[model samples]
Target: MSARFAFNHATAKFWDQREAVEACARAGAGIGLWREPVQEMGVAATAKLVRDAGVAVTSLCRAGFFTDPTPAALEDNRRAIDEAAAVGAPVLVLVSGGIPDGGTIDSARDGVRQALAELAPYARERGVTLAIEPLHPMFASDRCVVTTLNEALDLAAPFAPEAVGVVVDTYHVWWDPQVWQGIARAGREGRIASFQFADWVTPLPAGVLTGRGQLGDGCVDFKRYLAEVDATGFTGPIEVELFNDALWARPGAEVFAETKAAFERVTA
Candidate 1:
């Protein structure tokens, strides 16, 4: 089907910043970058480097932590939009942060709505899209409260196309019974801003958040994910974003090579 592919920087920390982008360029792949690493290299310099290396940036890692609903947090997201624009990335992934003190999930969701109200228009004006990424329900308590594609779409519906959307990460939504339906709806509504893949596993060690499995190393069906996303007419890059500690400890080149091969194998 000629699907495009990309890699997230977290999968290969063993390679220095430049080599990671260079490797992706060499592989003829696109990239999704985390804010910290990019900030370290200086956003302008990082943009120049990626451009010089001829790599397409699929999306910026994240922006929103709106569960707090504070002015400072909202302002930070605004700056994130600026950074995404500066780097020529079309989408800024937003992870709706966890519940605020004494607030319920319902209240936290309201925070997302409020934050989006303020930030979506700003993002639209800047020519950047905000992609609300539904984190795993496992993270519902601390990391992010939005834990399903359906929920993400519900949040996105109130905003314009250029202003708000959803990031469908397999690691987070694989267990969702309504995932296929959700993907169909996302496609029908034209709101699929990003597509990411990672595997699921048992015996989750400490820091479960960092234990994302490499493609094909766990129980997700990539063929199904690919088919569904393609069915939506969403032609964006499929990004591989693993957070495995084992992977981070390996040589970056080795992780990249293995991940690329695994991606090809499963999608093949």
Candidate 2:
């Protein structure tokens, strides 16, 4: 079976948000937009534009980061769910926020649990699924505290199918020893909300967060991932979400073309 591809809007940050979406539509690619870009375009307007362009809003880039577990944060996530619903996006990717001041990773995980409990029902009400994305363990200090697909699935276990799920991103999780098992569990539990691809590279870049590689530029067995997820009957859009400075420096159209080519090649 062939894999369908989606482009995360950040991959084309050089272009205006709406223009990026339009470009993806023109390229016959699905779109995964970040919240800020969507806000800049106005949720309703962006939604309408994407719909008019005949493009699929595969997923909203993010909504979680509710580590504070405050009422304000929960409200913000609720609003995010509404925005995703407006854009006809079924999945709202969630990055469980980093460790709070003087807090342990375990404590941060607890905060994520509480945040999910509060927001899952709201997301379900709005017909949006919250997809918990586990960032790389290297980011366990300052990015998402959820650092593995297994942990993410365990976190989403309590929620019903439409309320909570997990996002599997290759850049963040490809190095995990238990990734295969996690993917299988995500499938068995029906928690595979989104599947993102970005190649992994080494050399300890200063800003490790933004140095993702193009699909074929690094060492990732994407075919293995595709086979694992496809075995779960997950035929959802495979989103390319690279954040490499090199790719970003290029023109949006060039980046889009190269990413699409890479997707085709890797999944071939």
Candidate 3:
């Protein structure tokens, strides 16, 4: 399956931004970036670095966390859109914020709806797609209210494709019984803004943030996912965004090499 593979820098969260870009450039691979490092390095400077290296910034790590819809949060997200445009990445992945204090999960989801309604136009103006990522259900209460591709698509359906979309991350939605159907529906709706790969493993670490297993290290049926997404005629970059602490503890270069190999092995 001729899928275009990209490495998400969160796999080595401590890696220097320049080193990650250079590694991706050397491997002829695309990269997914995070906001903290981009901000620390200066958005324009990082943009120049990626441009100089001739590497594709597949998508920016995140922008939306608007469970409260505070003016400050919206402003921050707007800044993220500009940064994404500056870096030449078409999509700004959104981790829909968790439940707000004194609020239910449903209320948090409603907040996401309001936040999207407010930000979609801004993103469209900047030529960036706000890609809502439905994190694993385990994180539903504290990390992301959007917990499945179906929910994400429903959230995105109200917007134009270029203005808003959804992310299909294997680690997050692999356990959903209707995942394949969700992928199909996402394709039919033209909202698959991001396709990410990460295996789900047991003994989720404290906070369950960096517990993603390496590709083929868990039960994800990557080949089936690839084939299903392919059937939708959605030809886009496939990114591996592992958040394993073990991988992060290793050298970024070594981790990058191992990740690329794992991606190739399972996707092949």
Clashes of 1: 0
Stretches > 4 Å off in candidate 3: 1-3
Q: lDDT score, residue 78, model 1?
A: 92
Give residue 123's error in model 2 in angstroms.
0.5
User: Clash pairs of candidate 3?
Assistant: none
Best by lDDT: 3
Clashing pairs in 1: none
TM-scores for candidates 1 onward, in order: 0.97, 0.97, 0.97
* Candidate 1 regions with alpha-carbon error over 4 angstroms: 1-3
The global Cα lDDT (0 to 1) of model 2 is 0.88
lDDT of 1 by residue, 6-52 (tens): 98887886568899999898899998888888899999999999999
Cα deviation of 111, candidate 3, in Å? 0.5
lDDT per residue for candidate 3 within 1-268, as digits (tens), equals 3239898999989999999999999888899999999999999999999999999999998887898899999999999999999999999999988888999988898899999999999999999999999988878888898998998999998899999999989899989999999999999889999999999876666747878899998889999999999899988999999988889899999999999999889987
Please provide the root mean square deviation of candidate 3 (C-alpha atoms, Å). Answer: 1.2
* lDDT of candidate 2 over 98-144, digit per residue (tens): 88898888898899999998888989999999999999888887879
* Model 1: worst 10 consecutive residues (lDDT sum): 1-10
The root-mean-square deviation over C-alpha atoms between each candidate and the true structure, in angstroms, is 1.2, 1.2, 1.2
